[model samples]
Target: MWLLIAVSVFVGFLIVLYLASPLITPKPLDLKGVHVLVTGGSSGIGKAIAVEVAQRGANICLLARNKAKLEEAQSEIEKVLVDKNQQKVIHISVDISKDYAAVVQAIQQAEEELGPVVLLVNCAGASVAGSFEDLSLNDFKRMIDINYIGTVHVTRAVIPSMKKNQHGRIVFISSQAGQIGLYGYTAYSGSKFALRGLAEALHMELKPYNVYVTLAFPPDTDTPGFAEEQKSKPEETRLISETAGLFQPSVVASSIIKDVVSGRFFSYAGLDGYMLAAVTCGMSPVTSIMEATQQVACMGIFRIISLFYLDHFDRICRKCKQERSDPSSEKKTS
Candidate 1:
């Protein structure tokens, strides 16, 4: 009984330490005069981020495959410029996924017009949803090409310039699905998961050069692309995903930019994202003292709670399979 009391007191002391230590986060990087490049900047989260950065005095370059859309996005972003006297917003038309040379050329042109890109945001991506068995090889390849390879193409083009300057910020917009693979995301999940691995490796490689890397794991946001993806998503996928609340692009983009500016390696959106990042902290570098303390103290409890979530998802999948196998199974079982 005396030992139990001692243990409880010790645990309480640790909890207090975790709660109180270093609530302050690092100061965010100044955006004034920084040359910022955003891929897939024509719409959705990318467009939102571009608008936010532009409001902060960053020189903005928006890249997408559609000239018309890029023009429209640039117009929107330009309206938010912190100073009307700064250089005009730049827009490029090129498919980053299929043409690495073209992407590189576009970056060169943007740099010439604006300045060397000190901040690069990789947001050009797409998703294809279906069961693993139902998805075609082309489906998998397309997702990988746009979501994974597209990020590579843009990042590679900007790296040399960043390395030359020895200071830069690279942000990759991954998905919550990247952290925890869910049903009907076989191809899409794989592509997003690849982003996490790339970001982690890049974070290690770029840190010494004063370049920071951030991977954003945003939950479902209200975006045009997300709406399109919903059309192809399996019923089970939609059902499972509905549990996590959908967020606005502006909200997500705001959180991402805030984290990126602070030089954080992982940028999570909303409470779901916070929980997911905390549970999956693993070997990822922790920049926030409070975040590190939370992970150290609560990971085990979160894991236990996560098992219930996994079991719920598993049950949903099983039920869906059963219903498909025998349409009358529900009635019969009841």
Candidate 2:
């Protein structure tokens, strides 16, 4: 059929475009002497990212709630600095969700000590998983405060400097849960999903200023925060989430940094992460022509593939609910 031939031609064209993507990669920004501010940079993926950028010659300012942990992270990053003279590391403690004034003060102090923050990484976030009815209104509010508003506070503090400089990189650490809603993640997913909208709008608004925005969708990274989240996950949530395998924080941090430097709007780690991003490319901006071509070509196929995943997840939730309702079935399993 003519339709079949058209589809084949489109697929071939897209394959060629994807292969040429690297050739069309955006010009990478120089990080040497760049002032990089990372929120929640005391541990986990945030700490790992701080170490990476530090090694690349960016002065690092780590912000977190725990002074002791931030100090410890600062020490660790100091050990890996490529040039002691080129980059320095410092730590500040503030609860970004509640301390808007303190966050502004910390940024001012960091700018005076280091320089204006050329790169801002919003990595501070919190997650709580439970059935919707079981999660209190406070839980939802807390998730929004810590995950969404915290990002806004740091970003707002840094934007003026970046606008004045006329160049910057702002990275937001959003999870795969942000892209898709999973069971028992009502509060967490809502907060993460909000970042996508924020990042997208900023991308369009900041383009003229040459300030790039990157939203990273890291899947189930093996971080201290993730370990803590596991303790609170419902059985159904755990079973559904396990399908997306855990990744090391270093691997994820590296991938995200690569995307940031490349001026990618959406940064994803691992095969599943890439597939998810591609499949859900919907209205997201594409930095490269090749990327746009690939998304247009692959969207339909990936959507078909995603149905299988959705079915599996739905099946798990239904099975768990059924078990909970049937006392005899639950006892037998126990």
Candidate 3:
């Protein structure tokens, strides 16, 4: 029994390594001389991806709502430059709510000015945290409008030009909650879940045409948007967020850029997020079930395991505080 268990563990790890290897990498999304567009480039993960791609010598077209913020982001992108010969970036301010056709026009204009947009990042999104009962129809619609429909709008406009050029990369910055739904994330997760389905279907349709699509599952990114959501979240959601340390947008951006350049369909940004995705990818889920009892270590069980590690750091901090305050503990150290 022990030998069988060891064999299974070794096999599982090998399979993971095989799938994660970049040898399967396709054409690079390195935008050298190519143009790229990222919605929500005013700040956060979208902005980070913009910077990273710009550094690679791509001419950029920034998209967002605030004119001042877009200009500011363009300035920041310019500050990183070593010379004028390297490709530069441009800004176009538009609300992605698809509330205005002007947003679509702006994207087209960008493609015309910068050259066919070879990369698109649909990172503009929002989350409304509340009990299912507390959320209204309008709340749900708003989440859908900005998160899902907005994605459709952008992809619809961007792909036609990409098809004409026979090349492009489209990325959707989904969340872990989209994969494993949460108690208070019904609305947010719904939009992200739908986004994943769209990305999958789009990938199959476009692979023949050389256009690549990637859906990134990032867990609880440390963005200003998330900070704002935390201020009014339910206690249960807040506890969950605290356990899942807010991930940096740069981490998300870097991982996504690698996958995009490599023509991979999926990328996971958070440690726990990637682990969960790994388990999902390997549906047989080996070495998890007790061999003798045959008790299945299901998805729910795996999630609880993630929660345990997610809260470990916080628990250690609390333990250290208690130990420092206890006089007996101090004497033991001394």
Per-residue lDDT over 114-220 for candidate 1, one digit per residue giving the tens place of the 0 to 100 score: 88998999999988889999999999999899999999999999999899998899999999999999999999999999998999998888877778888999899
Quote the lDDT for 198 in model 1: 94
lDDT of 1: 0.89
**Candidates sorted by TM-score, best first:** 2, 1, 3
lDDT of each: 0.89, 0.90, 0.76
Every model's Cα RMSD, please?
A: 3.6, 3.3, 8.0
Q: Evaluate residue 53 in candidate 2 and report its C-alpha lDDT on the 0 to 100 scale.
A: 95
- Using alpha carbons, what is the TM-score of model 2? 0.92
lDDT of 2 by residue, 186-284 (tens): 999999999999999998888778888999999998989999989989989999889988899999999999889889999998778988999988787
Clashing pairs in 1: none
State which candidate has the highest lDDT.
2
Off by over 4 Å in 3: 1-25, 282-334
The better-scoring model by TM-score among 1 and 3 is 1
C-alpha displacement of 168 in model 2, angstroms? 0.4
TM-score of 3: 0.78
Q: Can you give the lDDT of residue 194 in candidate 1? A: 96
- Best-to-worst lDDT order: 2, 1, 3
Per-candidate clashes come to 0, 0, 1
